[model samples]
Target: MSFVTDHILKNPPVLLGLIAMIGLIVQRKTFAEVVKGSLTAVFGMVALTAGVNMLTGTIAPINTAVQTQLGVQVADGLSDVTFTAEYGGTVGLAMFLD
Candidate 1:
């Protein structure tokens, strides 16, 4: 139960997929349609995640270089923060609620 709650239920991609599936089901869609919709939602979430990671990866180096040139220092304990690591759950919950 914990595993299901922590992994499958809490996961944003799966939660989005489930929402898609449920919505389709409520609309009286066929099984195939529901499956396709759910898969599309999940895949879309995966793609969005990948794009964010790529953008962050591209920006981090430039940000570091600018900070170095300007003699700016990152605040304490914030040097390693990443978007997904910081707000992934909140993003997922917001998506689910919407």
Candidate 2:
């Protein structure tokens, strides 16, 4: 069961395909529609993931150059802020409230 859940349910492409299949089934779609929908969903996720990977690859060199030039200076008013206090209140409050 863990293997099935880990390999199938938790995989992005498989998860998207499963969701599409389930959605089509719930709507009583035809067999062709079910298969096409699931495959499209899976491929769509794969394409999106590829696009993001390309974007990050392109950005890496720019990020490195920027950091090299900027020399890791802190933001103007945030120089003394501890990491815990920096985002803790905003993220914590939003997490529970939202």
TM-score, each model?
0.71, 0.67
Candidate 1 residues 1-98, lDDT tens each?
Answer: 44545566557789889889989999999999999999999999999988988999999899999999999987755532455455655665566567
Which candidate ranks first by TM-score, i.e. highest? 1
lDDT of 2 by residue, 1-93 (tens): 545444564466776687689889989999999999999999998999899889978996887789889897435554223542354444433
Give the top-scoring candidate (lDDT).
Answer: 1
The 10-residue segment of model 1 with minimum total lDDT is 77-86
Task: Candidate 2: list runs displaced more than 4 Å.
Answer: 73-98
Clashing pairs in 2: none
Give the C-alpha lDDT of model 2: 0.70
